[model samples]
Target: MASVQKETIIDADPADVWAVIGDFIDGPTRMAPGFVTNSRLEEPEVRIVTFADGTVAHERLIARDDQTRRIVYSVVGGTMHPTHDNASMQVFPHSEGRSRFVWIRDMQPDDLAIEVGAGMGHGLSVFKQTMESPR
Candidate 1:
């Protein structure tokens, strides 16, 4: 299995960050607008996400904890078919007006780790830019 973790501190309140990421259905589009072109819920627990690079993924929500500001999901089907793919995003309070955003992805087939990690890195960068921008 390949496990990749990426984290960054955003210059925003934890609650504010949660408000954006907690939506699950629309969070990706909002968090990384250009990177994630569109995201919609196929069902209560299933989401279909379209990326800017023409990659689409059907992700199922595994868990969501409001108190802990964490959301877990798994990609069931998409352009890149993997035996196992699970990911989680969480926000933690940092300083008075900053929050730490952490993203972790675990998947089968170690070779995919590099590509997946690069995507995660780019996504996080866009997310940080979006969150820090004036709203």
Candidate 2:
């Protein structure tokens, strides 16, 4: 199984980042507009997030720890043409004023580094910038 981990430092406070992270359906509401066009919250911690590429993903918020500022999401069920099964994303907070967001898993049909890299790289940057951006 291949693992990809990346980190970025944001100027925003932990709480600020947490707030953005908790946005759930509107996580990208405060992002750099045109990035996350639309996001619809579904039943039972599920959400259908629409991206700029017109790509939509049905994700599930399986776990969330307010005390730890952690959130776990998975794309086991989505609207993608091929759909991503057995995939997940975790967002947690650490440090005085920082957060640790990770996307790790052995989603089937491995060996797609380029595709994964692009998504991860862009997702991290966008999430970081959105969280750090002044309110």
Candidate 3:
């Protein structure tokens, strides 16, 4: 089992940050260049992203808690996913009108979990950098 969590403080407003994060398909475009091969709308607004490395992950808008500004998303299923069962989250918070992005990935096991989770944490760091850097 593995678990990874990453948090970043951005100077932009939470809404501005969510504007970028909401584009789930753009995760590859903005989060990691060349990482996402393609993404399709599974339904009205749900998206499934296929990675260049062959990981197919599904994401749906689980819920939007306005009070917390937390955009809940989940991986219903995927191939070569972080684990046989995987779940993640993107927590958005407004601190002094700035956006604080929190990414959390929960997977089972210990050793392998840290490896995968750390990789994810690094990826999320890239995402934060790209999203916040004059884009």
Candidate 3: segments with Cα more than 4 A from true spot: 24-28, 44-46, 81-97, 109-112
- Model 1: lowest-lDDT 10 consecutive positions: 76-85
For model 1, the stretches where C-alpha displacement exceeds 4 angstroms are none
Q: What's each prediction's TM-score?
A: 0.98, 0.75, 0.70
lDDT string for model 2 (56-96, tens) is 77777777666665566766455453334434344455676
In terms of TM-score, how similar is model 1 to the real structure? 0.98
Cα TM-score of candidate 3: 0.70
Rank candidates, lDDT, best first. Answer: 1, 3, 2
118: Cα error in model 3, Å: 2.8
Residue 131 error for model 1, in Å? 0.5
What are the per-residue Cα lDDT tens digits for candidate 1 across 1-135? Answer: 999999999999999999989998999999999999999989889999999999999999999999999999999997988899999999999999999999999999888899999999999999999999998
| lDDT (Cα atoms) of all candidates against the true structure | 0.95, 0.63, 0.64
The lDDT, on a scale of 0 to 1, for candidate 2 is 0.63
- Compose the digit string of candidate 3's lDDT tens values, residues 14-73: 776676565655644556566556887788647787866777877766665555655557
Error of 2 at 90 (Å): 5.9
The top-ranked prediction according to TM-score is 1
C-alpha-based local distance difference test score of model 3: 0.64
